[model samples]
Target chain A: MTYDPVLLANIDKKDSHTLPVYQSGGGYRGLRRALEDMSPADVVELVKQSGLRGRGGAGFPTGAKWSFLPKNHPGPVYFCVNADESEPGTFVNRVQMELDPHQVLEGTIISCYATGASTAYIYLRHEYPLARRRMQAAVGECYAAGLLGENILGGGFSLDVHIHVGAGAYVCGEETGLIESIEGRRAWPRIKPPYPAVEGLFRKPTVVNNVETLACVKQIVDRGADWFRSMGTPPDPNDPRDPGSFGPKLFGLSGHVNRPGCYEAPLGITVRRLIDEYGGGVWKGRRAKAAIVGGLSTGLVTEAEFDTPLDFSAPIRAGCLGLGTGGVIVLDETYSMIDFLHNSCRFFAHESCGQCTPCREGTQWALEMLERIRAGRGRLRDLDLLREIGETIGIMPGTTICGLADGAAWPIKTALGKFREEFEGYVKEPTTV
Target chain B: MNVLDAETRENIDTIAGRYPTRRAAVLPVLHAVNDRLGYVPTEAVVELAELLELAPADVQDTLSFYGFFKQDKPQGEYRVWVCRSLSCAARGGEELLEYLCEKLKIRPGETTPDGRVTLEFAECLGACEAAPAVLVNDTLYGNMTREKIDELIRRVRAGTHHDATE
Candidate 1:
């Protein structure tokens, strides 16, 4: 790991979750700097220069997202910090919210100021009760200390931060779905363009950001934009659209690893280094069979591809979805590929918003097919059918409203593409008999 | 006929006021009622509609979409959610859940006869690092083992709570 742990610095301290403990270590100094010395546009410019990407799967450029709010809009612009860490094999937001909530809050306040958002909401997952309690308390502390709500630190800007808890829906993690949930509606994600930035949350412009993305905003002010950009990959000058993964990321390492926990490492760290150096290596002296590139939705990395860097564009080069929440789950050799695909497929099936027919029905059908294969009743031709379902369901293919179909498709594609023999061996048996 | 009491109604109104539209306050309002009343009664949904100035069906429309709300009846004293996602499943979470069911003499989503616990299969509690993790009501117990589960069940049965390791 080339970078020291920045976000997790105060996590292990005795009273880390408390505001005093956080502030004592120059916590709000970034907020103070932005509030006292700089303009809101300055903050946005600095972030744009830093090349920070969203940590919540999409890897969208944060500064670009902030700049998307229509200039001088007629209505209230909202900023929603997504703390809904419901992705399978992911818990980065939960740890940050539970242990270092003020960091997230400080980043949130700074982002709100830069984006001209007068109202902000921390959309916390319902399952995370502990994170909710601590974050709620931290919000109160910030309100009391003039860091949030009504002329924050006398900076001539005011923002109201509220905690809106989710009710056990993974779809709520999707930006538009989050907006819908907060509006007291069923958490079905809306179709874009009048994207959230234009018309969202009571038909007004809104900015939805990941918890860790906002935390990065606070650190960018503390450290120079150059310092933030120095760590992760720079833009591929060849690809104009590639914004390049930058800064330290909270990589949640789990499954078959000795030291399975959240680690703050730079964006370009390889799977080998992350597993051996930080994760204490695969458990029980077993060889790693496959690794989820970054959460189940991102798909799997074969043993040969373990050397691939986990940066945003690198994962795509490694034939998976972009670094989707940086949740790396290593599966040792003893683990079954059938189990892996089943769980990944099942999650997408269960969590699909059910609005889009291809994602809703397609995911369920795929999962049922996997269950049949697992139950020793699958045909040799069923694998091709599964692939066909996956290929047609995602937004990229124009079959679904959201990227969820794409997320569900990945593991199936990767598992079948890379670990086909394992799956073939399982299915070939029932077919021959 | 009167489902929401004076205190509950006041609480719902306070929650409803937080949002721009009463329709938008349906979730937080229902959460508050669910937290206090154990489960949201169908009649209370009607009361909340009147309070928020929406039709009862509108409130119910949003209410039924989310899985956490229990409209039929109150849940058991404790809700033990065993995660069965990839990480946890790889690390004995499936077996642990089965062990729990066998010991409790009830399948998942069923409450024990004594009304002490409600076992459910959680997708992922975002505690993958602590694979084989279970949430005993609101507290997440990470690095869970059968022995740890035994202690947890005993504690819950005894009507007690313990702090999660920091």
Candidate 2:
């Protein structure tokens, strides 16, 4: 299957970050069309028909998420564009914001219009100083050109966009956590049931969408829903269900790959093709030993599963987790699975917001066991203990306030389950001959 | 000691105006204070609390949650963050960090004797395309080598390196 660059079509153009260059490539047409012609319900229905799913790990339908907002909520409705791309192996959103800030801004404006939101916030990570500057500049440009401020393009829809830079915390990427961070508090994710659509951002109806997810909205509006649905496979075959991971996705390929960068490809493309064709295959002519197909939180996939379609459903059906933010980290023959798992465990342990007991305690205990095994001081029973701890934290959903604990546990459980021998080999008793 | 000058206070007010509530501007105001002063001093926190209409403890609580803000004292002139995450680690980011430590005669998370540079390890700066990346203050230098580290150190010491924020 050939790759079609929808989100990244203008990324390579010179001066692509500027409004003029972006406009030259037929940018902001989505916002203009939606404001000039379509109603809020019409825009939402178009997206629903487009079969667009959230690009931020969870493959939730983008239109469904927007439709959750109450039509006539008395108070102010808010939209938050999640630009905090802190997932360990994910860097695609960074490229989107840095290369084409206006694309994200335009998508966000269209979303705000569809959701009837007057205020929108772009929650950016602190590490991305360059992206923030570009976004700020672009916002200023939009205001000056009558694209953002009052009565946008004389369509009688006024929206104000603000950029909020986050402090160093991985959990802020969570929608509710992001809301909390924007509200000037610690990024502890709030309990749901009063979902963000119902109540968020100072207890107002809010819609929190990822940067990449919103970027897709622009194309869905500009090209129409049929064009959007024609790209990827559907979830079911005869009388299909949800749109099965449709549209072009940005895959951040790194680790041991010859070319480690973000690649734009259609969903359901084979992982082997992604590595062999786009990533230039494994680095130094080494065979791929294992790979973390999605982000660090997703389960590991061995070379035998290399042919698995890089979509939202196939990997989960193949005993691995679903395609997360599509951050693929390849491990070569020289890489150690145990070390990789250890690093993953340490990251989760350090980042588990400590909101729930199972997550806070389980993450720390799992790391200690992994460390003990790594240090060659492991008894045979440590492996079972690690699995038990991981299952306690992750096997059951809603074990923690947020998915951080689950993220911590899935990698450990999957790594141990797949590469138990490698872990066991590290457990050596004193030379008792 | 009135750590927040008139200019910093005015900046905080402008930031507060961007949000519906003044409390929403806490992070940006703290960043403003950090930019003016090397770190967010305790006195500055007290002043910020008063400015934002909250207790000093409330300001301190928010400050403590984040690792980016330096509360106690000033950091070095050039804050060097070496990426030590999986992608960069696979590309020898740990070795580059060690090399920087050896060349500077200081440990990770510690400042140099002359207070010119402070070395630390960052999880991921979202620039995995160029692995083995180093963030000198706000600027990111990717695909770094031992020679690049040496040159970076020299340039930082000479105060000639371009700031990424600029």
Candidate 3:
């Protein structure tokens, strides 16, 4: 599997919407090849070997994720592109969508053929108007070229791509949450066990994949899996990135950095390199204070661990941060830990959806305490209350119908544990809320 | 406001036609209306319901439940939506939102009397490290500052920023 970064090849500073240009570069060739030459199994096999994984923050193997669909469940299997990329720090999907939407459309068409799906849904966030426009145009272009809809590319397979925009909700980024939203419900997440593949949107067998993951499939089928594997840091023979980690990943760098945008780099690239080379190091020489590896739900790692290679297992092994959404956020000296945690708690509280009692009450309680501490009203008990709130939600993971409780709980728990001292000091010298 | 012109309606209808289910076209209709009117008004919601053959209540729920739907309230001519998600939050999204409010002399979710700008908070505009970022209507102004936000509002109100219809 080659990591050519060609997916991002068409990006130009002067021209953000570059789908037409991507077409000239043979962008949909993979979809063409699959429709004309291969069977669905062959397409799936190529992706399976390519080691592609879900880029929608989960990192699940793309081939395996598709395989979860029942082989003979029904005829109308569905492919839902999780284009609702609202996870904080994760903006790579939008860049890819805005720049080369045809690539996603092409990949989606191929995926539909492989999974025997006749219908596909691209559930995008409503906030991304430009991306929605680009994607809509690209889908239109694909339909014009006979690469979509009935008898695609004259290959005798019919596929239709629909772009559904979500009202804003971070939980909607969750696969089930997205499914529920597409079904015209409030964007609350549903319990797993029936994962989207089993009973997704309208209770059908569906394959919901991230925008980046689906795009990778088009390239894998076109270039072959071995070439794709060659570009990423080979899994360590001695201490290789775990079996779980594989291939080049698209990293979205943001925060206190000079240059911040999307970059397609190998999975094991160091956080230091991302901040130093790609991010142009910390701004104004303030020095890197802390970094959030994935997104908000991911645990925080301080500057001392910046060199930790960013692989699925590497960050966890470093024991500082959780591999959130592969969104590396660098915070410099100007950041206040107290206010930062309050802001995070507030987001969790606001987005809890109140489905589960623990998440509903606990997030609000935690935010209140964090807010009080930030507002200089912190008694020592406020820190303890924050800890208690985290504990209550921590036990609510499998208890809740969805993982939202767990998602909101994990960060609070991790933050309280990791930055206790900073939180503790706020009890004595709190910053105004 | 029936801000969508005939050509815009045709374009929007084309999107609605692509979906097999009328419910699927909800987002496209809202987008078309928002693009044209700068927000989804009650009239547009009713129009979307008629177009999609769904009840107006259904469209209304969809619009109000989702945070992105800017309703047809008296928004200032320009709106500043600041990102307040975890990534941005961790790196001073709150302070930036505050800075904008102070600079514009309007709290979040409040429209200035002069109709020049309305400042509001958003949940993650997706550019986290560009923390302190704000979306001025459709365009993203990353790495935001009070001065930059003020400059953006002045430019938009002064007819310098690209109009949404463009």
Candidate 4:
């Protein structure tokens, strides 16, 4: 695993946040190369060839997303960088922003060029004041260095980058919700068919990407596509259509692990290795019981399932959601699954935007049911009710405006499905009320 | 009477200039007010609406959606937020919060009688890598322990806790 580091190479360097230090370490070289040597179409083609996917939860292909934009659109195109890293177990984006703000800026400039966007916005989470300060400083540096503003780097490409801090909403991580938030409205997700590429952020063609995804773009431009694709194992070995997951991915390891920091590895690294080798095994010399591969929105897997590869498709094949934000939460034998689901449900209920009927109503009901069970007043049929509610909210397509409801429902269904016995143990026979 | 002071109004105007539309600066303007004034008063919302060219109701609607902005009254000098999410909870985050509440003689989301410290539970500060994290004001303290809490309270009371902004 002696692979060369790309995104995190300069993360630990002294004064890494400073523009001079970043430039000395070869920062903004991608922007330089893109602006001077490559065409906007060439940059997009390189990204497509590199097999880079969104580092945010969804795992959508980055280049393909850019390709969806209608070429030669009349109005101004926009680029919204999703720095609102609010996923419960994820902190990698915050680290990237804090340590190497210039890397994110470089990647963003490249993305704006590739997408034909003249204006860019970084939707940062409000809780991260340190990250915000660093980003503000870095953007100022870029503007002073002539890397931003009109005619950047003496090239005809011009882009304006602004930092828009989100007040406190998890749904804003959703692209359309982020666009709405940027528009000075509540972060309610818009329906697809008019995706961001078609109409976003003031009804103009927009490309919204996550922080880590944009950072990877800088590396993809610096190194050739084949060089970038050489690291990670793909989904299908034989078929190029699958593009198998490639490049380095940052895994946010936390909870009960001895070392709970963000670790970078190839996309298809095994979960067992990540937990034992990189995480330094479970804390207090305890054995790991279950693990949440991605964020809280994803399902839990038992210790036996630890062998599953950490990729977008591998975890889903193992009956969980894809590699979402790469936020791996480990639960030891001492932890209670019941309490875990309760906390997760509470977050969903509080954060749901109340846009759609099912998500608004379903999340609250699920939380109520979980609370009742935790209080030892749970009926035997309540488990069945929980299952039905989760399935109805998540299993059905077009049930809600965004995937928040589905994110709310998946953990409930998966937690109950795997830990039914633990849930059953908490159930009390109904006493006549 | 204007809820926002001259400096806050000027700061809000500057932020509004960053955006193409004045309405897009609502959150940043509110944040600036909260940073300076401690809480967003109803009068401030009315004034902000005039600044951003929106209705008072529109400002209030956006303000109500987010829990970060406190509208009722000024917060304590030190706002202590204990992370109670799963990762932090696993590593004594809840116990730490309970301990603080017992020592401070206040429940979560309540300020002490002295108005020096307000205790609250945060979902996740994105610092789970250092479990049982606590955020006082904007700066986050990680791997927090009982002794650390005691020291923090002492510093806040002594008016010696290092302010991130300063």
Candidate that would win on TM-score: 1
Q: What would the per-residue lDDT of candidate 2 be over residues A400-421, giving only the tens digit for each residue?
A: 7788877787787788888888
Among all windows of 10 consecutive residues in model 3 chain A, the one with the lowest summed lDDT is A390-399
Each model's total of backbone clashes: 1, 0, 13, 2
TM per candidate:
0.98, 0.97, 0.89, 0.97
Q: Give me the runs in candidate 2 sitting further than 4 Å from their true place.
A: A237-243, A394-396, A429-433
Tens-digit lDDT track of model 2 for B38-122:
7999999999999999888988888888888887678899899998887888889888988888888899878887989988888
Give the per-residue lDDT of model 1 (tens digit) for A175-248: 99999899888888898888898898888889999999998998999998999988888888988988888899
What's the interface RMS deviation of candidate 1?
1.5
Residue pairs in clash, model 2: none
By descending TM-score, how would the candidates be arranged? 1, 2, 4, 3
Give the proportion of true interface contacts each model preserves, from 0 to 1.
Answer: 0.89, 0.65, 0.62, 0.67
Q: Second chain TM-score per prediction?
A: 0.93, 0.95, 0.82, 0.96
> What lDDT does each candidate get?
0.89, 0.86, 0.76, 0.88
**What is the C-alpha lDDT profile of model 3 across A67-170, one tens digit per residue?**
88887885567778988887667888888887777778778888889998888989988678788888888888777878777897778999888888776787
> Which stretches of candidate 3 lie above 4 Å from their native place?
A1-4, A13-20, A231-242, A319-322, A394-396, A431-433, B1-20, B30-60, B70-74, B86-93, B164-166
Pick out the ten consecutive residues of candidate 2 chain A with the lowest summed lDDT. A424-433
Write the number of the candidate with greater TM-score, choosing between 1 and 4: 1
**Quick one: best DockQ, which candidate?**
1
What DockQ would candidate 4 receive versus the native complex? Answer: 0.70
Selected candidate, larger DockQ, 3 vs 4: 4
Candidate 2 true-interface contact recovery: 0.65
